[model samples]
Every structure is written in structure tokens, then in C-alpha cells.
Target: MMMMQKPLLLLAALTLCCCITSLHAYRKRGCHCIQTTHNQVPRKCIRKIEVIPVSGQCRQTEILITRRNGHRVCVDPEEKWVLELLTKLYSENETSSRTNVSTNASSKLDA
Candidate 1:
């Protein structure tokens, strides 16, 4: 009985250590992305622009051009429209820290 109890306690302790280490590693490997609106223009139509944060404070801007021909295109232009869209998107989709962490972990596994 004593021998069995020692091994069980050791196993429990090892499991706890592994859980903590994995949690830390996961946090370190994940990133936080935020989208924000950079600009919008009314040139016969509304062109919404936004930026998506790829990692940390780094972002990629995208422009959504709404043409008079009733067609909308998403483009990564060097214009201010991309910034506008990013801002709007980020504000609307911003998740809590816990949710973000889970999403990051899942994304990492998928990648």
C-alpha cells in the first residue's frame, strides 16, 4: 500500500507540473490581434477600410472599395480606407483575454 501511494503522489505532482508548463508555453506562443477602422470615403459610395493586427502591435491594413457599379472589393491598398475598416472590425470583434487565449491556442494547433 505504501509503495502504491508513493507512486500515485508522484504521478499527481508530475501532472500538475506539466499542466503549468504547458499553460505557460501556450501563453508565450500566442498573439493578440485587433482590427480597427482606418478610414471611410464617400466617392459615389462608401469605402470602408480596416487593419488587422497580425502579432502584437503589428497590423495589416485592408481596404473595401464600394464602387458605383454595385460591386464591393476588398483590397490591401496603401490608402487610409484599410485603417478605417480595421478599427471598426476590431472594436466589434474584440474578445476577452480568456477567449482570446483559447482562440490563439486553437489557431496555433491548426497552423
Candidate 2:
């Protein structure tokens, strides 16, 4: 009876661990947003913006906006203002990268 109890306890422990592991993986693979807004948020209040593209886990593009007050808001990616904002930021990044490359090349030439 003692040996039987030990095996049963071991099996229970393994089963519980497997259940917990699968639950955690499910949550990580799920979409991050529960709800999102379509209304335009004020640019002045925005502290940072994160754009997450669609993948096997998330079906739609997600735009997470962090406000100055330290609150995060999820905005609809298809909104006109959102599209415009992403486009402007993309251009700025491209220009900044180009400027950095040119500066580095010039510095190397000088050396």
C-alpha cells in the first residue's frame, strides 16, 4: 500500500506541473489586448508608443500608447491618426539612421 501511494503521489505532482506549464504557455501565446480604442489620443500626452504587428497569436496589429501619467492605452491600428503617426515616426527613424551613418562615415574618413 505504501509503494502504491508513492507512485500515485508522484503522478499527481507531474500532472499538476504539466497543467501549470501549459497554462502559462497559453497565456504567453494569446493576444495582449483585451480591448482597444479607436478615438485619437493627444500627441502631447503620449510618452511612448509601441507597435506590435500581427502574428499567429495576435490576429490584428496592436498599438500600445504610454501616456505621460504612466498609464498605457491600446489604440486601434487602422485609425487614420494612428496610420499617420506611424508613418511620421518611420520617416523620422529612417532620416535619423541615415544621418548617423553619414556622420560615422565622415568621421572614419577624417581619421
- Maximum-TM-score candidate: 2
Cα lDDT of model 2 by residue, 18-110, tens digit: 999997887556576789999888878888777666777787777788888898888887889988986776667666665432332111110
Quote each prediction's TM-score: 0.32, 0.61
lDDT of 1 at 91: 50
What TM-score does candidate 2 reach?
0.61
Error of 2 at 57 (Å): 2.0
Q: Give the residue spans of candidate 1 off by over 4 A.
A: 28-35, 41-111
lDDT of 2: 0.72
- Backbone clashes under 3 angstroms, per model: 20, 0
What lDDT tens digits, residue by residue, belong to model 1 across residues 2-111?
99999999999999999999977864533222332334445446433222235543334333444555555554445565445445445554542223423331221110
